[model samples]
Target: MKKVNIIYWSGTGNTEAMANAIAEGAKIDEVEVSLLAVNQASADHVVNSDVLALGCPSMGQEVLEEAEMEPFVESIESVVKGKKLALFGSYGWGDGEWMRNWVERMENCGAQLIDDEGLMANNEPDDEAITNCKELGEKLAKA
Candidate 1:
């Protein structure tokens, strides 16, 4: 079975809900899923997984959450090379420039992105957005 790791950071549970949905979808494909908060996840889990799903809501000035997620993401940089990755997050404002820049950064680092990008806005995730997140999980599992 394929193993997928979902590591996420949420300030108000928005991104965490999305992470849970993604994990649920991944299970539809019979893939083993490990869903963990950013602090709880380790680089070793990322290195061993077939797919890496990262979630972090937009923070000040449209950037990743500084305290935990940023450090977590940075820690996996060396191991992310050649890994299939999917980015997801919730944004309260801005034009999703953060997600765009993040995707570019991951690609530049030699991590293969599975799709365009995964983004949901505000505190609640719409059905369409949730479905998209699920589809992202399926895609990542296949990749």
Candidate 2:
């Protein structure tokens, strides 16, 4: 079975909800899924997974959470090269510039993006957003 690990740092529970929905949607009979908060997810987890999903809400200045998510993302970059990756997040401000920049960085680092723009929700995710997140998960599971 393929193994997929979802690592996320969520503030205000918005991104966390997105992560959960993605996990639910990604499940497949031949796939195993593991979901972890940034603190619990180690660099090795990212390195070992067959497919990965990362999530974090936009923080001040439209950036990832500094204390955990940013550091976690950096730590996993080299290990994630050429890996199938998906990114999802929620933003309270800006026009998703953060996600655009993140996607560029992932591409530059040799990560294959599951979606062109990735996925983003403004603040709390509604039903449509949750469904999108789940679809993202299913895609990753197939990857």
Candidate 3:
């Protein structure tokens, strides 16, 4: 069975909602899905999963959450080469520069992103954003 681990950090519950919806969509006959907060996950989780979905809101200066998500991402940089990855998040302001930069960083590390631009919702995810996240999950499950 394929295992997918979704790790995320949400300051306003928006990204967490995205993660849960993704997990719901990823549940398939041959796939096992799990969700964990960034603080509760580790590099080993990323290493063992068939696909990894990461979520974090755009923090100051349009960057990743520095407290936990950023460090976790850095920890797995070497291991992500050739791995299938998916990224999603919620943003309160600015264009999705954070997700774009994040996607580029992962790709530069040789990680294959399921959605090249990743997924982003403004402030809070509306129904369409949630639906898109589920679709991204389905793609990740199939990847």
Candidate 4:
């Protein structure tokens, strides 16, 4: 079975909700999925997975959460080359620029993003955003 690891960091729980929804959608016959918080995950999880999904909210200045998510992202940079990746997050302000920048960074690192543009939700995700996240998860699983 193909293995998928979803790692995330959420400050206000919006991103965590997205992560759970993604996990729910990733459930399939041929795939095994694991959802973990950033503190409970390590680079090895990404290295060992057939698919990796990462979630984090857009923090100050439209950047990734610096405390844990940023460091975790940096840790996976070298290993993510050629890996299938999916990114999703929630934002309170701005035009989802953080997700765009993250997608670009992953692409530059050679990771194959399931969606060229990562998914984003403003504040708490509405029904549509959750559906989109699930779709992104399905794509990640199939990739």
Candidate 3 per-residue lDDT, tens place, 52-128, comes to 99999999899999989999999999999999999999998689999999999999999988888888988888999
How many backbone overlaps does candidate 4 show? 0
How far off is residue 20 in model 2, in Å? 0.5
Clashes of each: 0, 0, 0, 0
Find the 10 residues in a row with the least total lDDT in model 4.
133-142
Cα TM-score per model? 0.94, 0.97, 0.98, 0.97
Question: Model 4: what TM-score?
Answer: 0.97
lDDT by residue (tens digit), candidate 4, 1-143: 99999999999899999999899888988999999999999999999999999999989898999989999999999999999998889998699989999999999999988887888889999999999888877877788
Candidate 2 lDDT at 62 equals 78
Candidate ranking (TM-score, best to worst): 3, 2, 4, 1
In model 4, the runs with Cα more than 4 Å from the true position are: none
Off by more than 4 A, model 2: none
lDDT of 2 by residue, 1-143 (tens): 89999999987899999999999998989999999999998998888899999998888797888999998898877887899999889998689988998999999989989896979998999999999998889899888
Model 3 C-alpha RMSD vs. true structure (Å) is: 0.7
Q: Which residue segments of model 1 deviate by more than 4 Å?
A: none
CA error at residue 116 for candidate 4, angstroms: 0.7
Q: Which is the better candidate, 1 or 3, if ranked by lDDT?
A: 3
